[model samples]
Target: MKKLYSHSSFFIFCMLALLLFQSCYKLRGHYGGEQSFEATQRPVQPTDVALPKGYKMEAVATGLTYPTGVTFDDAGNVYVVEAGYSYGEIWTTPRLLKIEPNGQTTQVAAGEKNGPWLGVAYHDGAFFVAEGGTIEGGRILRITPDGEMTRLVENLPSFGDHHTNGPAVGNDGYIYFGQGTATNSGVVGPDNYDYGWLSRKPEFHDIPCEDIVLAGQNFESDNPLTPDSKDKATTGAFLPFGQASQAGQIIKGRIPCSGAVFRIPATGGEMELVAWGFRNPFGLAFSPEGRLFVTDNAYDTRGSRPGYGNGDWLWAVNSGTWYGWPDYSGGDALNTDDYQTNKEDPKFILAKHPAKPPRPVATLGVHSSSNGFSFSSSPAFGYEGQAFIAQFGDMAPEVGRIYGPVGYKVVRVDVKTGVITDFAVNKGKTNGPASQIGGGGIERPIDTEFDPSGQALYVVDFGIMPMTEKGPAPRQATGVLWKITSEGGN
Candidate 1:
């Protein structure tokens, strides 16, 4: 990650301009007013990280660029992935990296595809990568140890606010991945414009995995694509702006649909739907018992269908099942006064339901951004069946207004009882990223994995990417990799 950014004057000027843009909107009261992007003087050592009573955290590697996930090969060599995009419109080449025991890192592979590569996994002799597809489109790629790469699936609808997330290889020898929705809920609104994608991909919109009938719900917003300020567009769910859906209107679904989970042969073949109706199911992993689980990032209080006080979720996957999206959270309908983010209360946009959505395994924070997770299986790990999830934290103002910071820690969840506990976090009185408190601790952890022996857990920390008002000022080479091991009795 060295030489990626030299703290150039041009970058600094851009950040200042971006800061000025965000300051103008602070009077709204609900949007981000003040922020912290200044680099901290205190370098956070592993000892600065807080862990449960009997565990210890150590720094394994540092100075990575937007590192998202980590994996291990058969020989026990460590591998990590760097997501290419930083969301504040910062773009860099996504890379696959191999870490040596001495702490030296080598770039195993670099991507040509549009990025923010969310996750990766090793199956057989190759690595499966989830290309975020922020601009061109989401894709799944198979890469060898020597850097050769091949696309297994392409053209996934992920050019909106979200992207393609997981590539969890199931025991069935098929690669399962999650495709995120484009808009906040369904309708393309001015919020999409703020995300900087709606204008670029004016025709881009969410696609359903199967045929669906709409309830004719539509949202009105000033068209960002049009030059006229007064021109408005009435858009419906799953359709582009200016396109309207009537009552009982049908939208055809295709294979690589948005807001759904799909599977394809590990070697590459026909893509099949495992489940549908997820907002942005970012993380996917299989438990020791073979049950598939995912972490779904709940809706933000933005866009046309924003809902308030909704938390992220963890779900146990079932084939041929429909987990609620847009219409529900935690298996409950969204049309409620409590969930009302704007003037009118939100309501169901679908004409019919496929089936009753199941209850979530557990519920996380409202803006925790609960993401990549792994189940603890080895007895040495102590948690056994519990799952450890990395909360990437929240992006205020961009996502929505916030009273205080949320997430920015690791939590252990008891899948059986649906209970949760903080596992690893920054040493702070306030729950937020290190930048918020000026410490060199876990800033934003994105993903983690237990070693082959299960004696140690490797965490991928997405270093300091703090809110700079309208855009995030993500520092290159700020990412760090951490390891956790049992210290004593638990």
Candidate 2:
């Protein structure tokens, strides 16, 4: 108790002096937000893609976050949408960038949440970006050339494991977009039995099932079931039992969200279904001749994780056609025996649908994750109708799903002949031991677009693995925007 008050006062005085000194030190430029890049010495060099002899590549702009989708206005200005981490991962924001023809890039919109702007298209003098959706789901956004953004459509179902994304402007003037399924396989019931259950478990569950299962039928009940009771008891299940019914029995069409293509009118109207039965359609485009093309990712499972034997495809999409999923892969549609059967429903259409009429226009290598494609509009390259696909490369290596030595490359597909050839390759090596490139290098070329002048092609490199285990510290900055100019062009 001896002079305790005085001792406390002395300590407080010392703390105040230290705080003042620290403030002064920060004000003296020792700290405080650091220095801007412009405040430092020279400007950072642009990151460019290395192209083959007939072509040159350069980075029109750098320092963008995760620039996934890129498009050009009719006036030749470049517009890029950034998926600020928020795709799948938490805390990611969204942004949009504008690049002038002279290579000056500026941020038009930033700090937007729930926007992994996966796809963008120019239509009707406005820029449309597919913001993978907000926390509420995916949406289509309209942005003016001056950076004003408006919501065109919202509440689109995108929360499924495989989300709704990838929007393109069709020749018909409608905006075409993708909606992906939630499950890997279109299996009915909780046990997740396949088509084989028909013969294997005829007594264990009802046999010879219909497509739509009645509700509440899977559960066992003691009472003799009445018609209304059976209907009320049937819950959507594998075998029609109790009140439960099979998937195809109750639902008129195939299961919802097995992946579908939709068209939205530019002037604002109801969204219409264009196609169904896709796994994950990442890119959509129309040929100069007005044919629709879509690149779909193959279904991946434990045995097919790396998708080595399975082939990805580019299809000439037709209206109301089914690009078989779970029921088929590559050009081979799985036999009906591969699926399960139930007793409650009859007339179950077997998994006998052809994926684009037994052939894809071109077959991309398995697990290539072929994404955003653009037909070359350039006259100099003489590739007016040729399509270029950005291959994200194979992710699984332990499964021996090797995609050649050149991992990250864009492939050019001959629309007429369905021939595929390497369009360009990234020179830098990848970091992983099994990585095709020696060192950690350019990765996951996500999207591509031709310059407004149609003289060059711009590719958006997502620049990192989509999934990473607890190993390795997370690489924070990994996205890049690259440009490839055709040979002999200015």
Candidate 3:
């Protein structure tokens, strides 16, 4: 066992430690928070990551910052989006780069100096991007081969922990993407405001706001409410949405904007809502069968409105269907351990909701923060037709550090039964007992892309932070590109 540090001080130490070792799976002990452990120094080489018996993994490039989206052009060049902003620092424009077979990386476009970009895709000599967390709000922009940029959508409510993500092109000549919620669990309270960068705005800012769903009927304090607690139960109703306004007052079925999925036709027009009820949907992809699938980031039990997350999920997305949020987790009725109950009963919200959202096809590990995903099409990889998702892992455990280091690797899901199986693992520094949780060498994988010939799979590693850190380090020039293939064959 190692020493433990208080969460407050540990966050500060991690922020300042640039060359910190990766400890993605080390468990935190329940003590008085007097002792803390640090990872021993080790070089992060291609060999640090592990693959199954017949597979091999290696680094293609390194030294990028906070890379997220990955895609390939017709010319065999790899394009990646480096999210420019550090969590708590000044906004820096993210970059789109073109990488060649020789490992040379060239900048394609720096969308904006102060805004961050999360998702990207290549289509007909152009690159589409999802620019998030800006004064202008989340929007999808298109970049020409020569680097000219044009905004496709704008004024999206972009704040809180998640942002607008994805821009994959569908076979029907439509561009699909995801829009995340503005507040955690549909409430902008003090916990969100404390993050400082979060704008504390309501999630739904568009039409169809007329009959949104609500969780609790009235505001009740799990802890003492303060002026900073901007929850609708504390502050007057949020603009253009909240039906009632009053501190500790009761209101009928709450109306809130949950996370959603949207699509824009290739011919170009308005962005249409395809599905709703996600918390923080981070990744989207279509299977070889032409079915759409998505990876959603679930809720946290430490927020202002605390509740146990059933787990993150991979859903076989359906148009015009509800997937359950605020009132549900992982398709089951949401746990109401901390809110005020109404006559309709807090427990039955899931049963009574008219839309009756469908459950996930597969349940990911709790707090795994599942991100990008893609379907295996090439017979060379052996798992053709299976879907692969990047479990980016969780940071800042809720309460007593319960679910730290649950993700951090790639997983393969059975399309037929929705069963999840580990495809990659990182045994960390010592290969200690905790290493079974998959951390250390692999770090945080953000997106998975397969080569045109299907002989190779590309993975974007978003670097590694100490599992104990509250969030990602402001800036670490450690992003890497990993290629995975069969060792004996392929």
Best by TM-score: 1
TM-score of predicted structure 2? 0.69
lDDT (Cα, tens digit) per residue for candidate 2, span 101-163: 665667776646666678788887887777665355667777776778887677665543345
What is the Å distance of residue 462 in model 2 from its true position? Answer: 1.2
The worst-scoring run of ten residues by lDDT in candidate 3 lies at: 30-39
RMSD of 2: 18.1
Better of 1 and 3 by TM-score: 1
Q: Relative to the unseen true structure, what is the C-alpha lDDT of residue 85 in candidate 1, on a scale of 0 to 100?
A: 87
C-alpha-based local distance difference test score of model 1: 0.86
TM-score of 1: 0.91
All-Cα superposition RMSD per candidate:
10.1, 18.1, 8.8
- Candidate 1 residues 153-192, lDDT tens each? 9888889988999879899999999999988888888888
Clashing pairs in 1: 44-440
Highest lDDT, which number?
A: 1
Q: Each prediction's Cα lDDT score?
A: 0.86, 0.58, 0.66
Candidates' TM-scores? 0.91, 0.69, 0.80
